[model samples]
Target chain A: MKIKREYMELGALATLALVLLVAFPLLLGGFYLNLAGKYLSFAFVAIGIVLTWGYGGILSLGQGIFFGLGGYALAMFLKIEASGSNLPDFMIWSGIKVMPAWWAPFSNIYITLAAIVLIPATMAFVFSYLVFKKRVSGVYFAIVTLALALTFTVLLVGQQSYTGGENGITNFTTFLGYDIYSHASTYAIYYTEIVLLLFVAMGSTAVIRSRLGNVVIAIRDREDRVRFSGYNTAAIKAFIFMLGALFASIGGAFFTIQAGLISPTVVGVTSSIEMVVYAAVGGRLSVPGAVLGALVVGFLQFYLSNNFPHIWLFFLGALFILVVTAMPNGLMGLLDRFALSRE
Target chain B: MELMQGQQGVIFDGANVPAARRGHCELSIRNLSVSFDGFKAVDDLSLHIAQDELRVIIGPNGAGKTTLLDMICGKTRPMAGQIFLNDLNLTNLSDFNIVRAGVGRKFQNPSVYEDLSVAENLEISIPRGRGALASLFFRRTKVVKEEIRDMARIVFLDDLLDRRAGHLSHGQKQWLEIGMLLMQAPKLLLLDEPVAGMSPREREQTAELLKVLSVGRSVVVIEHDMDFVRSIAHTVTVLHQGRLLVEGSADEVQADPRVIDVYLGH
Candidate 1:
């Protein structure tokens, strides 16, 4: 039987992911595990970018808005839980007596979780519907999304009483009755994040390999042709974009729980563009590549910002330019070339 | 159904289509006019195409041949017009909705997905799981696979199904695009300069394929190749300055003095 190259490559990737997931926890401890957990959560957003921008051909530069929205939602729930029906410290500091109506539903964990996914999905639906209905796409769509992120950041920063301002929602002591600060809880979060990341990566691979994936890519290549071939182009784009938003939201939720904070800084234009860079460096079209890109970039940022804080920004800018020029397909493309040459 | 009943030419309601009028008017346009800025691209154009008819549209460069197709396919909405595709009023519909109403369109350029394989390209146009939820868990059954193979066979790409569409020769890419359209099983196929870049041999094959395709559907071919048009066209519609100059058999159109003066004269 002739083995398709795609199947072989997928098999190799799955094996690699399995090995990494099982071995990483054993090799790393304490601070490293916590850091890896955070990175894994960030991978959710990167994988989402792969599905939307890479596959669907919808480049959203404001994904930080969705990520921030999700993280903030979960953070609110966690905050209220920590507060035990009382007003959060920031709200009290801002001289607010009553809990905001929006913050009331989040006191229930299930509602908060739903909002974490629904908020971004709803926002995506409204935003995508309006934009795509008018047939606005390409760079215009990117600019709109970027503007949204910027606007959202400003709004979050300005609303000190409701949003806790630039400091964001923080100082959470518990998550679902577990003492999040305890070593056992941190390990649980790390393991859960790793498992979720692996599943998400696998799920995305399945999606990209499905029949819908072909149509999505076709829309990316020749949208008019796909439309004339009887597929609703805008609806398809909206669906994929919404799915991407949901993934980012889920990642945000995970980040809030693991890191014990959700801040406006992560939802701003800078971090939003950084998410795309992760996808670009990993291999925008490859699911596993997106995950690897997130981990590598996340780790590098942590290390470089610590050791050479002043040079980190310059290094990142240079690296982005180099990757875009020299390796447009990213680390996966490089690895693919090496593999093909070896073969 | 309402649009089909009130048209000038023979019209068939989709549900009650008579056996004798199987080739009834599939597409009917009335008083269609469109302008881009100050220039009138398609001015007061009206045309009726019957089912199973292979109608060829020939025009000079700025004669609005592409714009006509664009309007029909809902890529460009007419400033004033009514377009009916049997039971559907296609004038106000979006491009995809118009397509769903059984109007398939091919552009002047071969526009297959370059990054995908020939089989994948064909698979995308197979009208299943069109909704978001259904597409999420779309599974390819054996029947769908066989159908894709059949479409590939029709386009002469059965052997090249695994090859990337971008790697195909220009003629092959054109055929792949036509195959993609065919996979949707549309009632009407609007081809805009399909054989524009094809070799004579490929053109001949395309003509033969299009003739076979017209057995169960309507086909509108917009081409500059008079020889190719004469070979397959049952009727020829000549357009000069976005207005219909004449409509007749191939020889009649070729011999028309008005056609020569306006289009062939150039």
Candidate 2:
């Protein structure tokens, strides 16, 4: 634990939340527990976004690719298991008797887990290596990462025969013999997600506090100076990009279990953009800020759509701008200021 | 110290750059040119630096002095021509590689990591490099910590060791930057406006520091401070309109008619 003293404060908070999460499922009942499970995954996604945008000073707009990859890993295995005939139902329904070679890896949980972690990290690596190595930063970085997300969404949308496509792969829930819809199962998943979220939050805190973190902030403040100081800036950026992707994929994997499905709609261009929005709305620096931002945004969407579903995205856009234009550092900054003044 | 052991009453003013081996090739530039878009920032310029000579490049504004330093340090590549350092051709060398090859640079701005404590900043500077992770595990094994402290004492910043670098006064920040560069232990130090905004007393002390620094290493300094340049430069290379107009000893160059005209007219 002392190997990383950087994230100690955030670790404390995360530990507190984790205890609450583990206990809440049993105390609060199944429906609410599943909703809380959804929150942890969302928290992971926000932490991932923060690593790039908040710390590395990278403008990544395509976190959805990793999220989608994680979701697809679980979805593919679940579907394959459900079919019980080697090929998932979609491939058979589309007149393709053979499963794609790419889908073969998800049959084993180890491979699926590796895919959950590595695929997104790899995507981040390749994309960020190409971009940051060329010194593409600022809005240029934003555009390229967003473009990647857009491409993934388009690919998923068109691949209806293999994937579920626009309608998405949803319903028929169970993971490794546990019923996804079961009350205990929901609590189990929620607890697992909370643990993952705690780690991401703690990991990011350590990263920001480490010497590597100093280099990150230095790169943010003065890239030319860091370069002159003999750091391979592109390599550092790649490292952070991969780290962010890992967090995003973890969130995506948990997202699949909570929602019990995977599809293009959930992990699309807009979803990628929404990741940035959460970071921006979360104050972009603190781990707690990201978690808070995700929770607030998630609740806002859930409630607004529950009332007037048609204007939900519009409300989202407006809220984002309002928060950005006014608060700048998100709700935590606001809360901190309020508490300070009162004291 | 041994160089002067053979001679009696040798003056030590940091003006001696280490002598190069007869044919080692320290740095060579040929028809180097760099442009931004259509504008010629530095055009058709060429220069050579001896193995360990501390040479001062003095030029007026827009003389491409900074740009020239940039080329030497691999911060910018020439649109035309090649830059060579020792055995290696450096035109294609990346920023970090160039530094790794011992071509370190200090910018005019004091760009130290602001939030880090002075000791922490110094701790990071020891150049354990690329994988500082392993270096951290073996921090005490390295001599960098002691060296950093020794350097702080040399720079007269030993007392400010625990203070954050950002809290330092302007001149103190500068000494910290120089200390950071010293931590690199570079072969050829490329300095751009090292004493631009210092107080008079600070400027005098900096001139003294530069003099001490020139004894054993090669330094390519871009400076507009004529008096400071006069005090420290072994040989002054005057630049005008992105060209090397003349090169000579400080006193000899100051008396040159063209040098006077360019310095006055600009």
Candidate 3:
């Protein structure tokens, strides 16, 4: 029987999920598992990049803003909960007696969860409307998003007391009344991240196969054709961009939970560009390729930082250039060509 | 070609749009003008298309043939003028809204999505639940499948529906684009240079397709191919220096002395 390409993709995703969710946890010890969890969280952002930059053709250079927002929202809530009516440690250290008015809503876990999804999506919606509605696209859109990331990083760094003064929010103890530092909690968080990643992968695949995804691709290729076909191209672009932001925000929220910290470094311009590199290295157009890209890049960064230390950045830069120049479609395209090769 | 079941009812939602008079003039453009810097691309051009009319526009390279279609489809905003489809004004509406208001345009170059298959291209163009949410949850129902199949057959692409549009020949891409436009079931179809890169056999097929397409709809075609226009044109409109020189049947327009001096003679 002839197998459809989409089915083959689904099979590959299932196998990957089985390995990551089942085999990795059973085989790897605590340290490696935790590291893998961190890498998997990056996969969320990579998947988002595929949707926005890869599919919708809206290259957002500042996905870190959404990720940071989601991470901070959860971190702020946890910090407040750990304070037990006292000010968060950073506020007290900075000599502020009162918690800011904005931080009050994050005290409720429900609200923080909602904010994790809504905040980034809202930012995306606003930015996309302002720019895409005006018919701005290509490099102009990229520059605007990059500027946004830079400005936001500066703002977070400048607001030292509230944002942990560049050191970022750290020292987590409890989450949802469970001890997050314990081995069981670490395992739970790892499993949770894996499950969420799989869910996002499947959901994104469904979307990419849907009419929405088709139209988004069409708009990416030929915007005027899509617009003349009676589609609100701006709205479609905005929606996909917003979805990308939502995925990144979710990833950010998990990053804080897994790493026990939310820092300005993660939301910086360098980090945003790094996230794009992950997508580009994976296969911008392939969701699974994006996930693998994040995993590979994350693992390489970990290994390189410990082994080569100073040379890691240069290595990454070379990798990016090579991927762009030599393999424009990234690792997935390479794998696809191999799969289609019949000698 | 017959429309799919349940498609005709929603073709024009009278509640949100003005009712279209079947036998009357379908598209009315009044005093339309758009200038780039001080250069007039289109200057005070007025045109009318009765229901089911196939109007062919022939002109020189810079005679504003494309700008005319661009203005009608809202790709380029006109400096002064009103475009009315049926009784609804379409001048200030955005590109997508103008399309939803019953005008589908095909660009000079075949603009179908290269990455998508021919069927998928037609599916996206079908105006079923066009909102972001609607498209997200869109399912291929029986009507949608039949509509796609019927459109594919109409465009001579039924056997190649699963082929990627990028893999198609130049003529096939043109047919695919026309198929996509027909999927919308648009009342006014604006085509710009549809046969620029087509073979002679393909041009004959397109002419036949356009004849059937204009049965229940109005078509405006801009082309440089005089032989193709002669075979397909119901009325030929000559444009020269951003203005209409003459409007008559194909033979009559060919015989006009001013048309010969300005356009055909050169």
Candidate 4:
């Protein structure tokens, strides 16, 4: 009977894939399709949050740090490709006569792709391992991650010459000598993003269904019991945290690709908290729900900000409060309740 | 005694023998001491538990019964002492490593994973795939499934296998935790007040369960209920002010003046 529910979840994922891959492309215009691609990028972070916060009981308020790391890693490669033989335009303007040594590795596409995942994963592992090993968790861990996001933003903004500062790395005309801005390329990129998103969703589902996922859930509820059960609770938590970072980084890379830029504003503390909101509104336990959450919330944010720019923040705040108080499980929880009552 | 039938391995029959005379004890604690700030929670305590013996430790609230279990299970580091489980020194090891070394502890509270099903709780407690990577790739083999089912039956939870642990009655939750520990197949089991919240009938059933469980392994329990202790304990150790007050048959300990003065009389 429990297995049946899992299959039903997989069916929902299939339905979601059909909508994203076929229905959206058929129904929406080119502009809306591109916008949908951007929302899907944020969905990656929301899915990662589901694993870390919803299941692992490790609420990281600093996910933007990993996301930024991934975005910046890919953006550096894109910027290098756009600049061709000269220093990136921002570096030239900032009076930097030569490319920084750190940026040299990202100039290679393979190295950049590896760094997009590895850098964030390594950082998250080391940080989480050190903290969790000390048995620091709950609100204290959350605060530490929040501080990390703040510190990361300050560091990026402070180092203007190398990082492109607050304005961030932008104005990418080409990716590997191909005009990325062309209509055909844009559609291609959108389709590629959809495929990658579905692949990641499947991977996340597999992890959630595995024994490791059970351990993660167990740790979330009774960490001491898990430790007494002959498992190193800290190591398990750190591994899951690293996995979440890996997902966020991939999303960050995708975000940079779709949005055409990477900025401190997009990867700062506020943005990290907003990413958590996407998970919360989607139903943090459901992978497909997270994707739906990102799309629905992302579209709402766009519409509200455009129509009622001054009150959008208040509206978002109200929505979050409403979800937490009335529907702790988010949209998926609501849907499940409806389904259960119907049955 | 009939519960001892069909048991394998060495079953130590000399429950009354002195610690120095025993050839090999399953658990040996020597001069164990721990202090929080300047207060000694457990002070200069030494004890021995023989294989297949069911020993119950009874004490007043502050007499360090739970603290002794804590130190033995590696939750609390002793300021001074050595804890030996067979040949291995468990004093300095981490809690999980101690568990891996074949010691299972049930806390005072029924600390089973409430969100998980009864079967999953048992499955997670199985000895294999304890490492992070190992757990990620761990499969539910037929042997593992049988083990879980057998353990559920032992704990009287076979019918509730798919039920969420949170929904179980308090006594059922306690049994689930015991079943979880059994899944580890530990050489030594430390239970802190196993029947703390159980009803009269549940307590009697637990007593029977413990007798059957003690056939092949050592069991140390901390309990407040004297009747429950009398029913299951092969030997009772009375602790007073972080020191051993008495060690004898349940009736002898109940009759001891020091044990009564410090614990039961109050």
> Tens-digit lDDT track for model 1 on A298-325?
9999989999988898888898898999
> A-chain TM-score per prediction?
0.96, 0.92, 0.97, 0.98
**lDDT value for model 3:** 0.87
lDDT of each: 0.84, 0.75, 0.87, 0.89
Clashes by residue pair, model 2: B14-B211
Which of the two, 2 or 3, has more lDDT?
3
Select the stronger candidate by DockQ from 3 and 4.
3
- The docking category that best describes candidate 1 is medium
Chain B TM-score of predicted candidate 2 relative to the true chain B: 0.86
- Taking every candidate in turn, the Cα RMSD to the unseen true structure, in Å, is 4.7, 4.9, 3.5, 3.7
Structural similarity to truth (TM-score) of each candidate: 0.93, 0.88, 0.95, 0.94
Which scores higher on lDDT, 1 or 3?
Answer: 3
RMSD of 2: 4.9
Clashes of 3: 0
lDDT of 3 at B262: 89
> lDDT tens digits, residues B16-90, model 4?
334344333489999999889888888899999988799999999899999999999999999999999989999
Best by lDDT: 4
Pitting candidate 1 against candidate 4, the one with the higher TM-score is 4
Candidate 1 wrong stretches, greater than 4 Å: A1-5, A12-16, B1-25
Worst 10 residues of 1 chain B by lDDT: B3-12
TM-score, prediction 2: 0.88
